[model samples]
Target: MIGAALLVFGLTLVLLLSIHAAEARHPQADFAAPLSYREAQAVVVAAQAREAHLRTVVSQPLGSVNPELLPRMQTIYFPQTGHHLSNRSGFLDFWRANGQLQSFGYPLTEEIVEHGRIVQYFERARFELHAEYIGTPQQVQLGLLGREILEKQGVPPRLDEAQREGRYFPETGHTLWGRFRSFWERRDGMQLYGMPLSEVVEEDGRSVQYFERAKFIYFPEELPAVFRSLQHSYGYPLNALYEVQLSDLGRLLAEQRGINLAPVPQLEGTHTWHPALWERRVEISIGEQWLSAYEGDLLVFRAPVATGRDGFNTPVGDYAVYYKTPMQTMSGCMAGECWNVPHVPWAQYIVGGVALHGTYWHNNHGTGIRPSHGCINLRLEDAQWLYEWTSLGTPVKVRY
Candidate 1:
């Protein structure tokens, strides 16, 4: 096996050297240009900087590229293209020059073996995704979701209010049209996929979290296009598309290339899970509310207790399971009435000092809609079992 690998390596070296020498003779062929002493010195500096930039991209899971692939690439590959590759700087230069499936990260044939660089089926040329979605990663989701929504249900024409002059409504009226007058006028007709823009947020005003961190994937959104249209009346596809989140897909492909994931995502540990490994996560609807908890992703224990009757509503947010104490004492009342309560062994999650433990004074466990100072109260034994089973950094997903 070693001998065979050596032969392949030697052959590849010869091929690449021949390409370079031949290109130098021709003065221009692949990517680099001729170098005088000044240009050579500049090339050396530029090469180092370009390498640093590719290292950055390798470090991140952008699009379908993997984080693990970054380390392998850094260790194995050497940078040659210094300047004259598109005038972008740093990571942007790497992206413009070498990171595409069609351009630099060229797809490899079976005969070609990349010792460290990411060699995949992807041709390194056709990566136009970067050009289309550049400002923020969120745009990828919007573009994909919008196209999916449109494909499933065709675009409705803009709305026309009969009351407005010079604006006409079609006889079929597929699109709910609005007047193009003032910003405030008839703007109500335009909606995202079918949901009114006003209802984009919940009553409490927390922007809806589309990506669920525990699963490292986007929570499935309903098929707005299919559900609303006659084209999808039978609903052939369950969801408009089996959409993968921008980060998740990239992380998945990186793993396939024998890449070494960083600190938290190490291999051969007591617990090692990548976002790509999960098949499906179950969504548990405990009460009238929907909150997600993955089976292997987290451990859950429920308890009930008394809460504020009036002003002190418990704010909801995501937190990590920090510590679980066997027995602790609760002294000072939240209402400023001091009382030392002993024998409270709470399972604590340190997202704003909240806990899930047994309540000695109250029997109702997270259901009667009673308010407390944000700590969950449960029976003593359940608390013990949960504390035993849960690992540090396990997430607690609580929503109503």
Candidate 2:
């Protein structure tokens, strides 16, 4: 009887140990046991989920027609607002996102399921939202005319519900986006682009009375969502310059200030530069003492600047504006400390980190003094002017 009891106890102990060992070896012991259905479903579901996310991320949100993409079926007739959406100006309420499967196509790779249950699911999309940019000024002009400008003269300037056809912006002086606003405030224009020259009464009778031509450029993500708000449309109005020669905002100001106006083809004597993305473009002429600004393909602004101790000889190379602090604590070998100077509402990334900005400490800007720590210095007003005149991405070229 004693031996029989012992044998039974030993058998029970062995069984329990074996069970514990098996449990430890199980892969899903930390969580739940994997169901046969779950394994299979996860494979397909995961693939579908990945596909959905990719298409969604690539496609533009369906708010307005993307001027560059093909119209999808989901983006059929726009704006069920009892108004016909024009294909030319692309007038519509919502430019629906084009994530819908254009046609039945096999996904590159989807989830692989080992069981019937869902491990993951992902659905691939065939097409994406159209990029509908209004490149031509004529088409854009007609669209703006269709949607009459709603001028809300309030504390915060805005253009409510005034849809942009190809492109639209109000003349607001508060900001630096003068290029678009320059076109929107025109008294008379055939089209914002491709318009022939015509006669017009100049505010300054001394300046040319002929109306300057117009131009339009299309960029997918040039402006941000906040700036695109209609309310801030009129905040950044044109300075003394934006009125006359709209395309080249600087020309209007130069003419108004009676500043020495360089002829349009200033490139005749010099090389006309075409800009590229993030190009290191700061042109410095030691002989002429001028600083030129370019934002990609456009020559935005140019001015004269003073360099270093004529000895440290400000290193000249193609550079971008890197650091833009409004009031910086400037320290140098010669100039002890410049406590405050209005520097950056805008500074382009050019070279390693140095940039061309304003100086309040030194009033004498163009007198040719070398009191700077390698950074080119401009007058406060000139600096402010340049600050408000460029995009953050503009290139500054400083070639000796």
Candidate 3:
């Protein structure tokens, strides 16, 4: 009986020892134990460093045009604003293609990760990178800085719904009237400035209306004294101020955040060409009956065009606009056909007697039915816009 009892005690001691050995080899996690303050700070620093490295890798151009050539990115430096724009996070391209300095102001910060997305601040805009749309043009988007600013200042009491007039927008419960509406339509405001956030309200002795992207302020006295002096010095039109001007909300916000405005040295990807950097070019596709206008390589406008039909085909060649007039009387006879056209609006002579002119007589443009007698026919509005957009010596290409 004593030997049996001693054997049981020995077995129990062995089992306890085995359990401790197993625990030493594979210990349980101490999830409840808090990290030390120093350890926690080190973890945060490591995470930030990793994010910065990832951003750098993403900003780099993927491949070169040739194995021998190094991949080149594009960066633009604004001397006036002492700011540089890197092609990081698609900011530089968007800025150039959109409105450049006029619409977005200068870059206030380099691309930085904000709320799990990359963003860069401009004087008047905040560009957010949508990684999901990386390859598309919509990858970068403008933040609702206008709306945000208005909210912080305390949004004015909502206007009575019944009293709203002049091109009302139900989306934002705002009315766009007077010169503001005209400017909005002319400038393609929906894409540029976004929806109006408030009706015209007096703020700091100025009439202002807030939009999702911008704040429009009415200049009752027309061009301010500073602008008038600039106009006089530069021979610029005073009306360019347009009675209503965009407030410098971008700059305002950047200052509020205490962002570093000092300019940095131009980066390695400093020299690359984009459509915005080139002269205006127009291409006419004879086969497609289409006209496309480009600023450098960027296609800014396109419209249907009626080229010469059959034997009176449009001369397919590269030409430059040597002469242009808003209104002209075109009288010509070709291939047993005579046309005595009166008041040909927006006539731009490209080669010999062949010109691009507004056609009121025919509505068939891009219907594959070319009816013009050698001249390229365009709709009145299209012709007018093209006429105003192009200057003398602008390149024009007519291709089959």
Candidate 4:
């Protein structure tokens, strides 16, 4: 009887040891085990609950939008997409500042948290919130969805050498050719899309190419029916069937993550929304030595300028930009003072012998140190931006 009881106890001990050894091999055995139908449902329900909580956290207004920009933050509803962009998040301003419809396309999802950062999705782009750059122009940045998508599929092998027929970027051993080349050159491709990562490849039965920041798909067929109707209704050219169209990577990635993209109603009690108030105009404050450029009511650019000193005051009146040149040799003699400067960059002649040009001679702007002869002087970059932003007959107003 004693031997029998000992044998039974030893067997039980060995069985328990075997079970522990199996568990040690697979540490996550409990978690890896096939869950029951009800357990799986519960897991999904918990995930959905977490997502709902995050959505609430992101949607609640943080009171972060600048008060001055509140007017421009008016909620905009896109009837075609059935989506509304709320101004509370300051996305509308960023969207408008950047190329709105042309660059980002329509909004795909409202502001949401992804990867511990607040973000929103547009049709072709993703907008990420950079709280570190808040109150600055770099507050909103574009996510690298193109690179991310390519990474998921494994990065393509780069070419050994750049091709000779088209624009070749030796940086990535990729060539931009054909319709893609035309589109890249026409649009601010380098700045907007970054470098091409791969040559054209077949993706989902379409000719597609990947860039560092964007994906382009060639659509040879006629414009979609909705776009055709928009072309007729809005008078904008929505017919780019022959051209390479940007893929809706933002929408695609959001869908892959099972994000909710249902359209929400327009927020109540917001200011009236306006579209494309592009009336390029410049205003100079002589007393403050400041210049402001406006597109309709939207203040696009502003900088300190060195106006004329006592006798050579920048004339306080309304003038139009009648002439522009990339570089000029400005030579003039006024009141016994003579200056013969060469290679003066970005000269936009607004008045007689008085132009808005960059000054490398002195940094005494925004103060009455050493002012200009009779013109307005600006920093090299500011002058360049203003030069590009203005055109012949752009209105310029000088005030005290």
Scored by TM-score, the top model is 3
Better structure of 1 and 4 per TM-score: 4
The model with the greater TM-score, 2 or 4, is: 4
Scanning candidate 3 in windows of ten residues, the lowest lDDT window is 25-34
| Model 2 spans > 4 angstroms off | 1-280, 334-355, 367-369, 385-395
lDDT of 3 at 46: 50
Tens digits of per-residue lDDT for model 3, 135-233:
986788888789889778877765455655589898987888865776677567887789888887777898788889888887757544543454456
Q: What is the full ranking by TM-score, best candidate first?
A: 3, 4, 2, 1
- Whole-model lDDT, model 2: 0.33
**Candidates' C-alpha lDDT:** 0.32, 0.33, 0.66, 0.66
lDDT string for model 1 (191-214, tens) is: 202221111122133222111110
Residues 121-197, model 4: lDDT tens digits: 99999888788888765677778888888878876554334454888899987888876776676456785687888
Task: Please list the residue runs of candidate 1 whose C-alpha ends up more than 4 Å from where it truly belongs after superposition.
Answer: 1-293, 297-309, 369-371
Total backbone collisions, model 3: 4
